[model samples]
Target: MSMLNEWQDYLPDFLDGLVVTLQLTGVSLLLGLPLGLGLALAMTARRPAIRWPATLLVEVGRGAPALVVLYFVYYGLPQLSLTWSSFACAAIALAFTTSAYTADIFRAGISSIPVGHREACQALGLSHAKELRLVVLPQAIRVVIPPLVGFCILLYQGTSLAFAVSVPELLSRAYSQASITYQFTATLTLAGLVYGAISLAAVALMRARWPRRTPTITAGATRPPEPPTRTHPSWETTSERRER
Candidate 1:
């Protein structure tokens, strides 16, 4: 009966917590996506100037613990005589960590574009920026979107770490509300459910954006298909015999 009463007190506090969680998640995506894509381009760069620095950043962030990064930003920044609020530090560190992983995803997507297409672009006399901006990246984006959205969902789950830095995000707020209302179990259980729902929704969104692999048929379906190249050798042989 007492626990049931405690559940009643949670509605308002949990809603407030959820708002902060969404805000942090939004800020992370806004900061991380473009930066991640740019870093991905950097990884593909042939120049040591760009490649080495991007490589170093991506490797270190991906290698390090997110929580440690959080702590470093939250606690270590103050030591250098630069002040940042805990929420700002948490958002920035989380965004940085997310960008590191996203860069690799972007790099893979961009590089997987067929070599022949790049040569085609060069043969057509397209400039580097023009080729990428108009042709290469647009194709790569279709391949990248699903995984990036999945990564963003992973990112959304990660926002819970913001609580460690004193951000009043869902998990942290649950802690406060539970502590005060003595409904720790109920409060946290609901919070867990909320996280699960958000993840499920994000996954569904990813699935909805799936790329179509094959081109749609036109009236050309009634036309004869081209003969295979293996059979074309006989035609070449016939041509040579006629010449002789």
Candidate 2:
């Protein structure tokens, strides 16, 4: 009963923090996904000049920890005369991390396409841009959807790291509440349960929307033979005379 009352008192603060967390996740994904797609495309460019730099960026983004990136954006950038609010800094840092990690996922989806599709596009005289727009991206995006959803869940959880920079997100709110009431276990446990609940719901939604697989032929099942072709009259006459 005391716990119920305590939760009622804490609910408003937690809801406010959740709003901020959702905003951060939405903004980061909106900005980062397009950047990640561009980087994925660049990495696949035929020119070494375009590919190398993009590859380097992706590698660094994946290699560096998200917390380090957040700190760098919030603390390190001010040294260079670039300054922003804590919220802005957190959004920027999270977006950078999202782009770096999602780029690989996008790249894998793009690459999984059969080479024959691109070849057919080329044979049809389509430009590279047209080929990707008309033939490639449509297919790749379908492959990427599930993994992208999973990544967004991770990024949402990662928003907790922004508490270090005083962003007032979910974890920060829970921490503040615990610090004041000295009910660390109950408050933090509630915060954790909130995060887990949302994550599980997202995963369930993703599974529901996931593409269904088509059935494939089993081993030992032979394909039907090709039909016989009819010989032309001209070829038949020439061959008959030569035989005579």
C-alpha lDDT values of all predictions: 0.75, 0.81
Report the number of backbone clashes for model 2. 0
Cα lDDT, model 1, residue 244: 24
Over the stretch 112-163, how does candidate 1's per-residue lDDT look in tens digits?
Answer: 6766667889999999888899887987776667667766766777888888
**Colliding residue pairs in candidate 2:** none
Cα RMSD for candidates in order: 14.7, 17.6
- The C-alpha stretches of model 2 lying farther than 4 A from their native spots are 211-244
Give the candidate number with the greatest TM-score.
Answer: 2
TM-score of each: 0.83, 0.86
lDDT by residue for model 2 (1-244), tens: 7887888899899989999999999999998999999999999999999999999998888777788888999889999999999999999988988888788888877876677778889999999999999988987787677667767887888888889999998999999999999999889988988887898898788778774453232353243211111111111245433432
Span of ten consecutive residues with least summed lDDT in model 2:
226-235
- Give the Cα error of residue 193 in candidate 2, in Å: 1.4
TM-score: model 1 vs. ground truth: 0.83
**31: Cα error in model 1, Å:** 1.0
Worst 10 residues of 1 by lDDT: 226-235
